[model samples]
Target: MTTKPYFLLCFVVGLSNPVDAMYYVQPWMLAVIIPLAGIREGQQLLHELYLLKKKSYAHINYHIGMFGSSALLAFALEFSEFLLVSSTSSLTLSVSGIFKEVVMLYLAVEYNNNQLNTLNIVGLVICLTGIIFHCILKFHALQKEKPVNTDLVVTERLLLRRMESADEWSVDGDSNTRRTSLDD
Candidate 1:
């Protein structure tokens, strides 16, 4: 299956977990994990390591696939959490959920297609269970956290300017209408 969405989900969720706190995760993590995964994936495809036999390779795939899956799951959970913190649900959550679920299901189907070992199957199940709890807890916590209304002053200034502009425009328009009526 196409792995793009899965990776994107993981990237977003992982990033969300911290960014909402105003503490950014180092971009270096992306700078590192992605290239590393790509390199390893390439190595696995091009040259078979003697140490990883046929069975061992399956384990490798399972482990890597599981990690990727977790990343996707975490990304989704983080997004939901971000929404929860906002204390209101809207179109945003719905769309995000749909995207996350579709990719998750796609990866799951691909993982199953590979004739995974029992260990891999078990790992997937366990990880899925953990993800469920993670989403629930994170979202709950987000709802509890208060959003920073730090921009109130700036917002007030902008609103005041807009209101003054609107008043000026309306006064001009009204005066023009009055002048036209008098002439008539």
Candidate 2:
């Protein structure tokens, strides 16, 4: 019933697909698309010329500047997201997106003076609590799965000891009597 195997299979298929290599050409695609989009927008603006005529030259220039700046920002954000997904994992990207939303919500509430009703506040708290618990569980899982290094290195002055089986030492035995099977 679990989707984990399906997800893994999809991931493997995605990696194996030769067409996926085209994702690396995203910058080139953007270069071609942006100019085409700009031309389309320019045509739309010309079609709506009457709306532009009422605005002063300075006002038009300021709005155009703001639009261009926002477009550039959008490009930067897209590129960064592409890099993030390429470098890390989809799960990391999803987690970061959630974190970004949380931060934006907090900023809106604190700096923009946006109001959240009781239900919204409660939902946000629950989301944060879930994220915290997820991180704690992931940390513990990783710790448990880590491979312990049992390889021994010899040096001239230092001696290394290896413990025997877990049941070798009896818990009820006195400290002096407690020893590993290797001691015998």
Candidate 3:
């Protein structure tokens, strides 16, 4: 049997995979889709930072060039599921509840601070509630007809917003690498 430390590491790593997968999918989607969703740039940027001067055209243009991971993840999920049609999870969905709660705390605080309009607020609530229900009631549960990338993209987009907001709210960290603050 593996040692306790190894098992603990495995558990922590497993709990973190969803967040990484979700984040890995976000930036690329932001670089591509969210910008083209036909909303004002400043408007969307505000969702990330609570309130910032609207992103300049140049800023948005720069973000468009950063779509690598999102593209790869979507492609992999598609090709693997449809073309290969043989690969499987090989692991149970029994992620730790504590990890889920930690993630939920970040999500809740970000949502509370976001300045979404009435329509967006309504839609976001519906989507978030659906996600919670889906995760709790069913983990591997998926609609066979819809591509999994749809969910990945959505989660990633959300992950970006939450990360951006949290990074902005926190002191002494860059949003990119997410370096944490330290006290002497």
Candidates, ranked, TM-score: 2, 1, 3
Tell me the lDDT of candidate 2. 0.61
Highest TM-score against the true fold, candidate = 2
Q: Can you rank all candidates by lDDT, best first?
A: 2, 1, 3
Candidate 3 Cα misplacement greater than 4 A, ranges: 1-115, 139-184
Worst 10 residues of 2 by lDDT: 151-160
Candidate 1 residues lying further than 4 Å off, grouped into runs, are 1-30, 33-112, 145-184
lDDT of 2 by residue, 18-54 (tens): 2343344457778999898888797776655765777
Error of 2 at 40 (Å): 21
Could you give candidate 1's per-residue lDDT for residues 1-184 as a string of tens digits?
Answer: 2223333343444432335432343365577787778877976655545546556566677768987998787776775555453443433454455566557667767976645578976886786666666667767776898977654335555767888666544234436332343453
lDDT, candidate 1, equals 0.57
Give the clash total for candidate 1.
1
Cα lDDT of candidate 3 equals: 0.49
TM-score of 2: 0.41
Estimate, for each residue in 33-103, the C-alpha lDDT of model 3 and write its tens digit.
Answer: 75576465766666745433565455544455555665676666543332221122312222333344446
Clashes within 3 Å, all models in order: 1, 0, 1
Worst 10 residues of 1 by lDDT: 1-10
